[model samples]
Target: MVSLEVVHASNARLKELGPGLVALFVGATSGIGEYTAKAFVHNAISPRVYIVGRNQDAANRIIKECETANKDGKVEFIKADVSELSEVDRVCKEIAKKEKHLNLIFQTQGNLNLRGRDESSEGLDRKMALNYYSRMRFISNLLPLLRTATTTPPHFSRSVSVLGSGGGTALDTADLDLKNTFTGSRCAGHTITMNDLMTTEFAQRESGITFSHCAPGAVKTNLARELPFWARTATKVLYQLITPLTVGQDETGARQLFMATSGIYPPSKPVEGAASASGVSPDKTIEVTKGASGSVGDGGYNLTWKGGVTNGKMLPEYRQNGVSKTVWEHTMNVFARVEKINQERGNVK
Candidate 1:
């Protein structure tokens, strides 16, 4: 496995990698997302970025930070709640209309410590909708635009989701939607694991798109703020104990920036350096071979924070029961249903 060293966020290499690239960041109001956006803007040669968040004031602050980092790059913020399908659809449509293609989509939107299962006004579980389904919907709605942006020069557009990689022990096919199975604090854990599985399954079926599900390990972010009081206190204590081992916010951003631009991960690359030599390669690695059109193969990647690709043990289950196909069909069905509902409500333009 490639040893991923923690580098300074202002590394000069990032600037060389980011010219003319357009990236959209969702859930970047704070945490790893926010730091990554700032790092990208700072190090990119001349990047145009779109920051998505629910808070206008926070988004504007992020934009200002980006502007200060690199005066040459353009930064724009789109305010929206990514958990809502209608809002995601609207934002994606606006992006599609404005740009011919998008180079990267970073999904870091999340609220851990959700006390209970809450459904959005659009009739879906809020956590699941935001962490999984909404991201899928964004990809589906903007796929055509992504395809249009790919030219002979090979402008690769990648979709990177920040969460757990590989199947968590808690995942169950029966409770894919988490409606009837699992409850309590484990619900968030289940949601994260299921989303990882679904993301891998979906990316495998959608060739040409580079998909990566990364586990950020543990960074001190605002993620724990939503936890119940006791849980929050416990987590803080735990973080204090493990702070030395955890990655910092700026380091997380640098790793993400590398994932967004590095050609080392193309579909045709070998997996020699991708796998970890020990301990469930924190960097989940998989190789995607290119097809005749130079698009990636069906299998997506599961990566660690450091950019190493490692496979989880549960992969065989997905391949055996055809979970990949099942996930694709189910996700598309959800998108279709959501689209129909939105249209009926006159929400889609």
Candidate 2:
């Protein structure tokens, strides 16, 4: 586990990489996303940040606090129901129009619920949509700007998704979307596995940008608001009991900022001896962890909450079985189908 002090030290150097860092925070209205947005605003130098989510009130509050934290940083709230792919595209289009390049994309958009298979208007299970499909859509749409971020280690273009990373099981490829077997648990498992696959695939294809699927660990967030009353009560009680063990929201934000800027998860095509460029001497530079493809600096990482690699025992098997390619093809097909339908409906341009 990386210590909070180390995380803070690394983040404190974000300014050394240069200023005018552009970032997009999907689902920053509350919880981890909000905290990380605040951290970015507090630490980054003259950052232009976008806060995208459904809650304007919450976004407004966050934006106000961010502005107070860094008067030079510009934080804009973009109202978006990102669970819908069309909306994700629209949000991405808005950002693309405004920014020439993006330095980081941090996403923590998901709901914790036991409800079974709630479908979105687009015919996707709402939980899966929020956790998987919508995130991929945002990344795909904004990838052009991400690719344009020409920077050195610790401040390159990167996308970090806070979800179940190493905690996925082998997928049932026949039911990748879990349309037929749509239990809440199955939906969660499928989305988790799909995130891993998608991250791996994107890292392999997009050589310069880094992709990470990370477990947020035991951070106290309001993710369980959608749970049943009994479940919500239980979580509250459990949270109190485990208060000493859980990382504080502020510290979690610092750690997440560390993941976003640290050279430990370098891009696939790393600059020769790039560790020295991360605002630290070579001897003092943090070691680079292996990516999801079992290669050092391969650009995809499944990270633990403490900034270590996850013990994804199923990842190797999934790779050998070519599941990443299968998942990518299926996801792209779904995106194409949804885009065509939304265009016909005049819901998206």
Candidate 3:
């Protein structure tokens, strides 16, 4: 594994890959998503970026900043609440109508925590709908566009979900939807697990589209506001204490961009040096890297602020339960139901 150094936002390395890329950022009105979008715009020479958010005014402000930062890049704002399926469908439809393909989709729209259970008008839990299901809805709706984008030379398209990928514990497959059982932590854990299961399923099915679920260690963003008063205060205290150790927003954005553009994590490439840009010889350990304490590896790429891929052992329980396939089928069923209902209402025509 290679150690990636953290750098300032104005570094020239970021600009090297941003030009000509078409990216859609959901939940970018604030927090890490906004910072990531700004980083891309700053580095891009002539990129077309779509900013999706609930607040039109805020979204416009972000786009203006992006334009000011990179005069050559084109920025457009799509105002919508991504938690709503109808809104997600409409936003994606507009994109399809305006652009031929999408090079990258960064799904960062999610509520950190709800003080109490809340449901959207669509009759779904607000957090679950926004954090997990809505993202999958957007991806399923836009899969064709993503595939079309990669048809040409140097085919590259990626879907990146910003969430926890390394820790899969406390994931209750029985409560995937959170209809009967729901708590702040349980909902959060389920969201991460569902994203992992769905992403891996999509990777296996859609060979051309690269999928990644990044667990951003920590970044100071407005997302902490979603927590209750006590929780928010506790989080603020911890954040202030840990900000020095956390990855900066720009570095987080660059790592995400690397995941999208870098030819790492390929399905067919011999899993040696698969993540290295230098094309060095592969490592022999079952794990990607061996630490002084022990070998550190996750079956998939578990990246740090610097873009290194490592492997780790899967829990025997999770491996034995075969949750991936179950989640896959369950998610598809939900999508099918939503599609059918939308069709009946003439929303999917």
Candidate 2 lDDT at 241 equals 100
Query: How do the residues 1-349 of candidate 3 rate in per-residue lDDT, one tens digit apiece?
Result: 3224423322345344335778899998987788878877776668899999877888888888887898999989888877768789899999999888887788888877755568765557878888888898889889998787656323446687877765544556676777788887777877776676665567666666666677766778778776789999998899989877987776677666654444444332223332322111222322233211122321123344444542223433443577677777777787777666767777653
Best by lDDT: 2
Query: RMSD to the native, candidate 1?
Result: 6.0
Top candidate on TM-score is: 2
lDDT tens digits, residue span 199-223, model 1: 5564555545566677776788887
Query: CA lDDT of each candidate?
Result: 0.67, 0.83, 0.67
Better of 2 and 3 by lDDT: 2
lDDT of 2 by residue, 1-349 (tens): 6777788888887776667888999988988999999999998888999999888889888988998999999999899777788888888888988988888889999888987888876878888899999999889988888877744334368898988788876688898888898887777778888888788899888888889998888899989988999999999999999999998989889888888778777778754454423322211545777888888878888888888888468778878888789999999999998888888888984
Model 1 misplaced regions, further than 4 Å? 4-11, 14-18, 152-154, 182-186, 198-206, 228-234, 268-299
For candidate 2, the TM-score is: 0.94
Return whichever of 1 and 2 wins on lDDT. 2
Q: Give residue 105's lDDT in candidate 1 (0 to 100).
A: 82
Clashing pairs counted in every model: 10, 0, 4
Q: Per-residue error at 234 for model 2, in Å?
A: 2.6
